[model samples]
Target: MEFFNNHTKLFTAAALLFIGLTIFVCIVPALKNQSENAPLPNAIALSDEAILGKAVYISNGCVACHTQQVRNVDMDKVWGSRPSIAADYAANYRTDFWRNTATVMGTERTGPDLTAIGQRQPSAEWHLPHLFNPRIVVKESVMPAYPWLFEITNKVKKGDVVVNVPVEFLHGQKGKVIATADALHLLAYLQSLKQTKLPEGIPEPNFLYKKSGDIGEKTAGGPKELDGKVLYITHCQTCHQSNGEGLKGAFPSLKGSKIVLDENAELFVNVIMNGYSGRVAEGYGVMPAVGTNSNLKPEEVAAIMNHEKTNWGNSAKKVTTEQVKKWMDAVKK
Candidate 1:
């Protein structure tokens, strides 16, 4: 009764007990887990350039918009092959003991997940311009341009890496836009963000959502039949737009494009399957291999070609799946 009446003693005891429990229950267990767990066998340490670029990424507040972790969910399959495990991040070091420095497994996803961005969008040709002016590549992109990371010079040195900025995006700049070393470093870091493969004992990826057909297989008039409108919306609308009028300086318009109206579909099919860089054109940027990336089928390609040919006040012959398949086979050869 006397001890209970002592408020000062009671408070001191409670404080000490709480502190002790926190150390034993939280701190000790965490330290133990960290110590016991080894980095995944295949986890590669970041190169010096990538490490520096990581600093740049952190300083630029990129972590606020992009996430590194891929969750175990159906929707997450678009970002990575499988859910990220803790061992994936074991090689990442903390900036300091008190703060979580390097492990930037962000919570918000203002941008796409970067767990496997290296594999997904590896081309420096795409990323450099995107960093310079995201809208130049993706007309609807809301990402801010990091133009400061680049310099416009009339005379590009022999060894300097040049960014192929479209004339419209250049805004009347005379010289070539050169990527700074920092930009290269940042690119290296971004390219280093590939998802490490799990070890033998780990379970294989279990995707929740499964599509029925193979890459080039689809039924005629069935639900699996290539919906040209849907395909255009999902893949093409971002750059080419719903009206088929592509962004002027970034992407070429498809509404009345010569390539789209051409009698022979070889070039068009090749462009979709392989990708195209229109650097010689004053206001055109690179087009990624949409068909390859989306795993589009020959029927889907034919459907898209037909839709584009007929839409936006254009009249042309519908492309057939057989034609697309023939072109694909030729390309492979």
Candidate 2:
């Protein structure tokens, strides 16, 4: 009895110490890991204007509606790629104690997730219009317009003292002007959509076509030529004719679509895999889903995209499998 009573206090003190250490081990790492695994902000290679735009994004409560993280649930599958990790965030993020980074990511999904949005839509012009008036790009968009982002000025570059307007705003009438900061910063942030590698392997989204000089002589028995023709006829012919004359009013004529003719060919592959729907031309309906075509292989898509450009009146730039693979990579925002 004497021994037990005398040691009771000492034993209790040791017990408490053990419990505290156990709790620290469990909790401290979790908190540290959260930030360690946090994604880096995929900031774009910003210019003076884009840097200022980043300030705008932080000031406005845009993060309230949009989330920068892509969870591993069904959402990632729907959007492509998997949930982001701390390494994915890279050096783009601005850090702080509260970690306001993506804390405001609401669960409502009122707007599309902004995780890899820059990869989905890389056009600066499109983003500018969409921000000024979401209705221009997304007719169904319920988002309010940021008219304050617009600014009007006669400021002209020293080189060519002609065009006062650097870009056309979405809702701006002839006289009104919008701030370009929103466009630049938002684009910088959007362009930061580069994620890690695919789980399986790197996807092939060949944006460029190869030439004989680029890859030596063409293969003899390879399906390069025939496969290209077949895929285009089977899939593309519905919208773009066998002769490459896309339907006049409905489909865009591929005869000279900048996307098709660009020397950088992977753009076509990304458009195909992602399935473009925006108004590349005015009044056109959303593009149909095509990457889901079971019969179409990544190689075949690359071939057709190349053949279409070079065939008919189009120039023949040989596309390789490698180029398509690169385009399939998570686009660097």
Candidate 3:
């Protein structure tokens, strides 16, 4: 009764209760979230160039179509090795007084998710041309080209980064397409989008609700034969078209290539495993090490090779997993 009569005492008690409630409700949970969602040990901090690229990414509204998140579903597995986790986005948060930027986990995904793009497509050669014109690499791509990020220069300087665009895609421009600072920064950011690996012994989160037909099955007469058409679409269709006709002067066509028709697959295996880095000098963008990047099994390689050999009227000898394994082992220098 005495405390109620004293207004100051009553207000003091109410203030203490408010503070206690805030500590219990807000502060404690925030601290727990911070501890549990700590950045992964394998997480790499963004480079200076990547930071600037992120700013460019934001300004261009790239988040509108492309998502950084890989949802926990079997269909999303193609975008990442594992399901998206809280720690995966821990590094994307930057809390400070002047600037507070949260993760760019976009809401809608018109384009494919970019969570593991760095691991999937690790070639600047592919990226540069793709940015210049999405149709150059992916014919049906709806993504807009960022041509403003490049400069057409008569003479590429000593340290200039050249973007190898198809001559047909250049639209009568004769000068070399050089990557400006913004383009280089954007490439750096895209290359840094690799998903962090889980710690050793920690069980990776399973992609829930897998479809029955998602896996390869054994044939009635032979061993398991994965759908090579599906594999080609997933790994190669963007650069090498569905018809096996890659763009002229950019990506070489595999339709009638000697490498595809060769009886001996030594050179073919080497090209897939290590990539043809020398292709840039030959006026084509370099091929990426798809086998290394995607962790392609011997069976997978055989399937792709067989698809390339048989399709587009090539009629080359179909490869087997055992043959591919032997050839792969031989070419591993």
| lDDT per residue (tens digit) for residues 125-175 in model 1 | 667888999886677788889999999998888899888787888887788
Q: Give the top-scoring candidate (lDDT).
A: 3
Model 2 agreement with the true structure over 95-167: per-residue lDDT tens digits: 3566545333445566767665545445454555556666554545788877566654455334321212223
Model 2 residue 148 distance off true place after TM-score fit, in angstroms = 1.2
List residue ranges in candidate 2 displaced over 4 A: 1-27, 34-54, 86-99, 102-106, 153-173, 176-178, 198-333
Error of 2 at 218 (Å): 38
Q: Model 3 over residues 202-318: C-alpha lDDT tens digits? A: 999998998874347788997778878888889889888888998766688998999999999888988888788666787776786777656678988888888899999899988
Candidate 2 Cα RMSD (Å): 12.3
After superposition, candidate 1 runs with Cα above 4 Å error:
1-22, 96-99, 209-223, 228-333
Better of 1 and 2 by TM-score: 1
The candidate, 1 or 3, that scores higher on TM-score is 3
Each prediction's whole-model lDDT (CA):
0.80, 0.57, 0.86
Q: lDDT value for candidate 1?
A: 0.80
